[model samples]
Target: MEAPAYQRIAATFRGRIATGVLRPGDQLPTEHDLADQFGVARQTVRAGLGVLVGEGLIVARRPRGYFVREREHMVYRPQEKSRPRPAVPEMDRFSEQIAATGRTPSYSIEVALIEAGADLAERLRLDPSATVVARRRVRYINGEPTNINDSHFPIDLVRDSEIMLPAYLARGTDRVLAELGYAQHRAIDEIFVRMPTPDEVHRLGLGPGTPVAVHFDTGYTESGRPVQCAVNVLPGDRHRIVFERHWS
Candidate 1:
């Protein structure tokens, strides 16, 4: 039996995209044009285009037409946090990584005192309703929003510290905590792959077929007291999460 008309139509464009015959921002032939070329109804052409849209291969612009999607992926390593930061005091780990790749990294931060929700409370070993300091940052690369990093710390542990102020800390929070006698000796990182929440979709400006990887990093002091919990949101289409292992 012959393949469905829509599949054949979709395959034609998919092949063209794969071969770079159709580059990003290149608009596809209109539904009427495709229907005429394939000798099919307009609905069939729409169904075919729908497949590409659902696959993140293309996007539809109502007033104009569909265009190939552009993608730029960033490498994200969870283990980087455990490594020592750059010797230069001018930049943090994120900035150092991006700068090494010739990309500029910038961020906006907001600090608030919020009631500890279930997830954060558990990670921080605090009562669910207890107050915690939330330090949120949206990292941008080349002036485009890249990822979200929102960290929560026990109020009693971080109150009045730079962690509670919405400003850049030349020395990261870890060092600040060390000065406060709660140095983190170890950390646990957990990751979950799922669809983005409505807020996340808006924050990241994500499109259809774009999922996200939610990472939770919990830090502990030498005495095993939980001191900080950070929730990092990485958009699937734009981030590649990596981990390395060693055997002793």
Candidate 2:
């Protein structure tokens, strides 16, 4: 079947942007001009352009035409999960990464003891409704809220420890876990792409077209017992997951 005129128009512009023919902040032709080119009405041109807008590929500036969006991403490497950190360093891994990249990092954290619902219970190998300690943080970079990192541990595992504190841990929580004889031996990474919930949209300050990437990082002890499960919610426009490998 033949596709609609709006879809073809969107594809034409999408190809141009992907190939770098149209760079960021470059303006698209006027709607009248695009209508004349596509042999369609102005409304049809608007519809085609709207598709790109919703995809976060372009922005519409009133009085002016639409332009390609200026996109920037925070590089996230999954390998950092099992990577080691300083013995008694200044900040957590996220803080270190952002500062290393020459950006200021900060966080607002809170700790709560909650019943491990299905989502967390299954990952931590605990019964549903089991008590657990939840450490939640809204991580910010250069003063902008960037992502959400919430770590969960069985209550019995982290009770009366620094992990139950809400202050910044220069030694980091992982080290505290190690002191408790639950050092992480392995980890699993799970990624999910979906639309943002209302609370997430409010907290992340997301725009109308924004989606999110939910990264579930679960860590286990050498004895094969689950020790930690961290839920990291990253905005689609704000992060890029990266991996590097070499052939031996």
Candidate 3:
């Protein structure tokens, strides 16, 4: 089946942005103008604009119309053993990774705790009521929120470690894990795309009908014990996860 008209318009505008035809901060044509040009209803134009806004490609101001936004590119490097992994500083690794690629990184920690839960148990390979540390964070690039991460760690493994402390007072989880004697030697990652949940829609500032990519990462020690499980949700339009494989 053919794609919807609103999607076509969104694609067309996205192409323009990608090609630099519509530079950052450039105001998009009025809704009526876009509707006339695309021979679609104003609602269609609004929907297309909403897609761009949700993707962090544009911003809308009351009585001012939509304007193109500055875009940031993300770099992804697979977790490697031979390759040197830096100590996790006192901040979210997701933000650190984004900043390393020349984009400003920002995020908010929603929850952090040592608790017992079914989700943590399943991922940690422990009993259903086993205690674990849970953390939730929302990451932003530039000024737009882009990713949500929920992480779990076995309590006995990191209860006294720095990862449990505030970012300012402690080193990050990766560094803390190294210090706790469970240095991560490798990681397994799973990626899938789907529509946003109601909570995700509000948390990620997504508009109606936007899909997101979910990444589940499991980190392990050299001894093959699972140390961390993280679930990351990224907006489909704002970020793309790249995987590179090299054979020995």
Candidate 4:
């Protein structure tokens, strides 16, 4: 079957972008010109361009033309969290990694006492209605929002601790847990791929058709008690998760 005109137009631009002919920030032809080239109406040109916009390949600038999107992706290794922190000043793994790449890392954190939802309750081994300390953070690189990391802990475990405070933890929450006598000895990481929710779109400034990976990291104390559960939401186009294994 013949592809639609809009699809052909979209494909032409997609190919150019993929092949580097349309580099990031390079402007697309004006809608009128695109319409003339495609022998279609302006609305058809818009439809075609909208496909690229939704795919995170291009963006529209009001009073200007559409341009290829520019993005800086970070490689994420879930296994690194288990490794010892480098001998350096107080900084979380996220901060350390981004800083190593010569990019500034920052975060917005909010702490609250909230009831454990079903998923969190199961992970934390608490009743669904039980209170938990929720430490919500939106991580950024070079001032652009990157991902969301919200950690939940049993209120009793973190009560009166720094984790309950709405502030940056230079040493990270894991260290705070160690100080609280609940040092984690093991953790399980689960990742799920799906489309972003409306709220996620707003928070991450995601374009249409952008998907995300929801990561659940549950940490267990030395005695095998669940102490903390962190949910990290990573934008698919902005991150690459890596894992390593050694068969002993």
Please name the candidate that would achieve the greatest TM-score relative to the true structure: 4
The weakest ten consecutive residues by lDDT in model 1 span 82-91
- Candidate 1: tens digits of C-alpha lDDT, residues 1-248: 98999999889999999999999889999998999999999999999999989888999999799999887778899788778775547878888789999988999999988999899888888899999999999999999889999998889998778788899887788888989999888999999999999999888888887889999999999899999999999998888888888998
Better of 1 and 4 by TM-score: 4
Predicted structure 4, TM vs. truth: 0.92
Q: Which portions of model 4 miss their true places by more than 4 Å?
A: 86-88
Q: Residue 30's C-alpha lDDT in candidate 3?
A: 94
TM-score of each: 0.88, 0.86, 0.68, 0.92
lDDT of 3 at 109: 69
Clashing pairs in 4: none
Order the candidate numbers by TM-score, best to worst: 4, 1, 2, 3
At residue 153, give the lDDT of candidate 4: 92
What are the per-residue Cα lDDT tens digits for candidate 4 across 1-248?
98999999999999999999999889999999989988999999999999988887888888898989876668989888888875554788889889999999999999989999899999998999999999999999999899999999999988898998898878888888998999899999999999999999999998766799999999998889999999999998799899988999
On a 0 to 100 scale, what is the lDDT of residue 99 in model 4?
92
Clashes of each: 0, 0, 1, 0
User: Which of candidates 3 and 4 reaches a greater TM-score?
Assistant: 4
Task: At residue 20, give the lDDT of candidate 1.
Answer: 98
Model 4: per-residue Cα lDDT at residue 183: 89
Model 1 vs. true fold: TM: 0.88
Model 2 worst lDDT window (10 residues): 80-89
**lDDT to native, each model:** 0.90, 0.90, 0.75, 0.91
